[model samples]
Target: MDRPALGDLEAFLAIVSHRSFRKAADELGLSPSSLSHMMRALEKRMGVRLINRTTRSVAPTEAGERLAARLGPALSGLDQALETVDAWRGGPSGTLRINTNEHAARRLLKEIVPTFLSRYPDMALDLVSDGRFIDIVADGFDAGIRLRESVPQDMIAVPFGGTTRFLAIASPSYLERRGVPKVPDDLLGHDCIRLRLPSGKLYRWEFEKHGEEVAIDVPGALMLDHIGLMAEAAAGGLGIAYVHELVAAPFLASGALVAVLSDWCPEIDGLCLFYPGHRHVPAGLKAFIELLREHDRRGKLG
Candidate 1:
């Protein structure tokens, strides 16, 4: 007979989205046991079982599903309304959640994040570094950062970080012992640090020269998932590595690694911040985009 608290409803939505009390608790900054008690209280207040919980799993009950289906859009509208009010107060103020790959995260930390946080004292940022592509809207992220080519067709993309390239690199010792690879075919005779994609497929080393494109199933005894790790292994003389130029930069500068097949690597379109075109852009996200554009203008001017 009493109205449920807004916080309680929001907590319920977080639980359903993650399908785990522990994860939802982490998101809400509450202990798992506390979250469990809150859910029990909510269920009692509503006079119905909302969540079906077992020792191994937790899921929403039928009633909970219907509630969530309705609550999702309602809460989103409420959030937008609140954000609209906040935007009128002057500068953007609130958390901006972004999903990005490791490389992009690193770049932001070095080139953008410090400036962003310093410039907007009222704003907070929640950055999730992930290798796999995800649905930003479903994941509740304001935006996502990935290579321009990888941005979804339906999303609006704002490019940054300039052009990037992948390089084939090896330690001088390794090249001296195994002979430098002259072409993509020559990689078959060398020990290489191969990459394992997030989808469980081994990434084929790709190269371009003039208009010719080459993809090689490079031979390797060492397989790594991280570009930095692959570059480190190559620098340690374990094997040749195919990695982003940024990943190999330090080693190359220090003379620990020498680039092979340099002519094959060509600059490509760079990283982009992408978001759903249909949704109203959050004030914090708009501020971030404006900053990115300012940086681009400065880069062009200099």
Candidate 2:
């Protein structure tokens, strides 16, 4: 049997990784029809049915799965080998894809992205904001940014920014109307803006003081998924919103929101950039890490 072209193999891997021809096409800069034709051609050449295609979804067949498993590592090795040549280029020049949550994405854009891009003009940063936790390696991402507590144990985590806290905030008018909650339990009587996690479950409001931890299933009519939206809703007097301090900062400064449970909401670990330890770190990613550390150090000093 003849071997498939390198590009065809890469396209197959991309399709398997995304499980969507359209998404793979977007990533590979090819049309979905073209990718489908290419895959069909690849299958014919290999004399195997590699993918199971349906109207709603696409998945690899058993043979395709085995092929993908082996091909994934081999492609990674090839990528690393090619990346070795980047050292001679005198600087990192490839794109670094980071899957991150919205809060971290905003922070990076505000403090780090501009400098990073300016310093490495040849490099590109692909920052994808997603609330749900995902396998970065399987998703073909170079790294991920999430809170330290959320980082996978197997991955190496580099903490950045600084320690951050969640604040239960409400508009002054709403607090005055509904009365302030002096303690976490007091939230039972007050209207609360609940957070809906990516897993389609409500996030129990967590608090700690003097080593005593409390989790509250606070009463609320409204539930929002995004932290920034929660803050805005609180500012609009919808109810109390528990959100990262960074998300609530502008509202706090403008006096649109006030922290109510400051004592209970102590600072925890900050955001971290995490990646798989088994693979060779890309030069662009290594450079970004260095820049991130430098920025964090300066932030701490300032």
Candidate 3:
């Protein structure tokens, strides 16, 4: 029997992983029609249908499922072997893709990234800032930065930065007009700047004090999606905003904003670098982890 082309196998895997011809095509940098043709050719060569397509979705057939199960490990092993070879090239090299929130990215850049980049000039860094949680392995990311609470238990989580606190802040003018909320319950009576999530829903303000946690549904005159935008609005006297203390520090120091319910604010575990435990981590990722650890040890992470 003639062996299938590597392109055909890759196309098949992409289609199965994406579950959509359009998505797979987009990922592979090929037109949808071309991807479809390739899949058809692959199926013909194998003498069996590998995918079941419908108007709304696509899925692997029984034979396709079996092939995927076998192919997944083989492909993973190939990638690992290649990475091991690449690691032996000496200094860390290769693009390191990191998924993180804007706040975490900012914090990391403030102290950790500069020296790391200077030390490993050959390594390229790709930082993607997104609010929603993502699967690093499935999304093809080298690692992800998120709050410790948000990280999954299966992943190895290393503290990337020190503890951080959340603050409820408002412009002095807004507070003078609307009055500051002394307690979490007082937030109900004030106009707050609300955050809209990527899922198109408002984020409820969360608070903790004396070991009691509370989620507050505060009324807002304006709703914004980005945390930076929400901070800007609060600074502009729009309303009270729930934001990370680090992001609000400058404004607080400049007297542009005033903190409310300060006694209730609690310090939580800061950003953590997490990755899948099941796979062999790339040398680039391993190097990054070491940098973070060294930064923490030297008290360089601020």
Q: Which structure among the candidates has the greatest lDDT?
A: 2
Candidate 2 structure quality by residue, lDDT tens digits, 1-302: 99899999999999998899997888788999999999999999999999999999999999999999999889889978887877687678878999998878877888689988998888999999977788887677889999899999999999887788999999999988989999999999988889898889999999999999999998999988888899999999999999988889999999999999799999899889999997768889999999999987787411
Clashes of each: 0, 0, 0
Tens-place lDDT per residue, model 1, 208-253, is 9889999999889999899999999999999999998888899999
TM-score for each model: 0.81, 0.84, 0.88
In model 2, pairs of residues that clash are none
Q: Rate the local accuracy (lDDT) of all candidates.
A: 0.88, 0.90, 0.85
TM-score for candidate 3, residues paired by index: 0.88
Candidate with maximal TM-score = 3
Candidate 3 segments exceeding 4 Å error: 114-122, 134-139, 152-156
Check candidate 1 and list the clashing pairs.
none
Q: What's the distance in Å from true for residue 39, model 1? A: 2.6
Q: Write one digit per residue (lDDT tens) for candidate 3, span 17-42.
A: 77888877876779999999999888
